[model samples]
Target: MNAHHDHTGPHGASPSGDALPTGTTGFTDEPQITLRGPAELADALPYTLGFHPTDSVVLLALHGERGRFGGRLRLGIPRSPREWAPVAEQLAECLVEGCERRGSRPDGIVVFLCQDPGEGESGRRVMERLRPFAQKLRTACGALDVPVYEALCLSGGRFWSYCCPDSDCCPPDGTALAPPGTSVMAAAAAYAGIHVRGSLRDMEARLRPRTARATVIGQERALDAASAALVHRILDTRARKDVRDDTIRLARMLVDRLAEHPPLADQDTSDTRDDALITHEEAAELIVGLQDRRTRDRAAEWMEGPEADHALRLWRALARRCVGAYGEHAAAPLTLAGWVAWSTADEPSARVALGLALEADPEYVFARLLHQACNEQLDPETLRECLRGEREARAQAGTRHAPGTRATARAAGARGVRRRLRARVGRSRGTAQGAPSTGPGSARPAEASGPGVGAHTGRRTGRQEPCGTRDGGPGGDPSGAGGADGSEEGSAR
Candidate 1:
């Protein structure tokens, strides 16, 4: 994870036998501190990933003689023994080849196998069980000519090194890990204002499926009611403009409300306040209303300034409300959450939200595109610029005929309004004109010619009523199929 090098000297004896200090720094401008042994490295893992990695394999790429850390990759440890080799090989190839692509081949690699002990099992036993997998990893990297500098197993509050042979330091029972925040690395990180939030599990919990059955049932019911009420308004061709404009207006109102009550510093309090501020019914209505692609795209304009943070909080709160049978309905809110997080430079949360979005609906086009962009490490500014340009264009067009004599003004305003409407219709039609629909309800669009994020939108057909409707009746299964991740039911996918 360290992206920079330092000239700091080690004050203590390095871990005996090939456990050289990881004398590398990350994206910070501060001087690097040295990690002498398994203990320090174990402590450094959280700092590296911004959260403690659990049941994961972390590969640290070491460059040159000083072993300056280069790139780092982490993946959930494969549970099946048969799959370990392939995963190891893939990890090795990705880190090694990826480094080479950037003009430097890693001279060495450091591997950390982190897993907690099962009930009644000791840390040593966990380490023993993972020995083969660690070996596979080392061998995989070695095959690419990048020797594993150190291979360590961290479990049961202790660490065991497979590469270090010094029994005094890396004992057979494993070395007790240094207490958190006591290491030189921790001190340096603190000096730089870098804080490791908590375990990855803790961070992900905020976005995970809530299992409170009653709450989920209520939200599902609300969703069903919202769907029943809004489906016709959203799909009726004659009312399309009104519906679209209303969706946008409601979205703006919510953003303004969120802006008035920004999140408090205490996360739990902030979340509670957010959930309380927006009612279940209101949240459900907006969630269903956002199914329109155009509506969601228009709302995406709330990307920066004070409104952006509040907007992000709103999306997150909505995401949390997407419970149980309404899980797939999370796609829109989750995508918006991810987009705002990414726009705000919170990559970890962005990746987590976007990944969960895919889990909710694998075929969700916006989620897929955002996930791909995030994984590829594309600059968020690229997408931000596109959105900003679109917003600016819209603003300029709105004011293009602001001033004139009353009669002339009326004519110009009418003509200007017509021009804008035509432009909007043309853009929508151009994107979806002849594209085939997906399944029974969804439609696909060609990529927009102008710069934008998603190449296609998933548009559900107007012919079918929203999922909760049965035989054209309002009363149907509350736990029915639908989505609220980003846009309209019949939007371009």
Candidate 2:
């Protein structure tokens, strides 16, 4: 999630002279709308988080007397209420400390608990069930001396406030949310060109692996064939470079192919067209070859312009192709998809993709770094500059070295590239003051690990060496690239 405050500017009162609600914030130079009560607060949740959260607990920090919005955090509501207390405590401290590091601790906090009812359960029952969870959140925030001014449970189209005791105003049966696009917050958001990107589940479904049995079988078979053909060459010292080059060549071709065909009006149809554009064999080759960090980093150079727009689509397509035992191979393409999304200012998708990348391989260094950076809201330009520099350095080395000695030069270039990238990453981490840790139970940057072998460990396909490494050649650079991938797995980890 993008933790940066959504609104930061001078405040204005509502036409009725009402104060802005605890959660709503103003956009600079845009028409400001005053959100009056729980109704407006509930309606503004989507705009604040950039999506309609489901099965999630959102905490928005408020600063000063007028309640200007500060940092925000969201986590999936724990299934077991037993876990709610600890989770609430962790979330409160994370958000509060984060705000402090950013310059001021929040003066107040607002909590939103959103979940749809299960089978045979009414919205009121849902609210009643989650009432204890809301109390836990309130107590957690209160423990830190930052009170939760309002706590709401939104379920099945109706909202109930834990902080309000007046049944006449809040209603014991719960009040229905305003019609979409009719709320004052919705109008102001639309005027500012801010759009809610649907529910988190919908955003994540786009990158998930194809689940149809036929598609899975076909894609898995293709992956097996590609692995058989390419793994040996990738492990061969002389052929590794060729494999990397071919991978880059194929990826660029696919990006161009996707760019040539504009997205169809319907997203599902557009995705289907994108899938059809690349043959199963082509996707398998690219997916298998991207295990090489250098190749994936080279492909990441297309992070802007028309190239990025199409590259994101292509990456998503490739991620969907990582099926069956090859599921873990998705870390590469998913990371690329996340990078492109973050670079293009699509934080929701980026977070989803990066989270999925970590799910694929928790030890993935590139995904971890990128995920942390995105969570911290670091300027994507810093990472972009690092990639551009690495590319330039390689180009210079290729020209400077003799043909017979270019391999040595390339190896040196790779080392230098890693150094520069790592330096930039370190600088970003240092500068991101008070940014919450990547996930719960951890407060440090993700640990770096060597590239993981393919997930099909039982098959014993030769020595399961990291990609880009050879028996007697330069080993794979443990520092891969700097970026993360995500999934909508109920948490941003």
Q: Of the candidates shown, which would achieve the greatest TM-score relative to the real structure?
A: 2
lDDT against the true structure, per candidate, is 0.61, 0.68
- Deviation (Å) of 170 in candidate 2: 1.6
Q: After superposition, how far is residue 230 of candidate 2 from its true place, in Å?
A: 2.1
C-alpha TM-scores of all predictions = 0.73, 0.80
TM-score of 2: 0.80
Candidate 1 lDDT (Cα, whole model)? Answer: 0.61
The residue-by-residue lDDT of candidate 1 on 364-389, one tens digit each, is: 65665555444334455545544554
RMSD of 2: 10.8
In model 1, which regions exceed 4 Å deviation?
1-30, 231-241, 401-493
**After best superposition, candidate 1 residue 81: deviation in angstroms?**
2.7
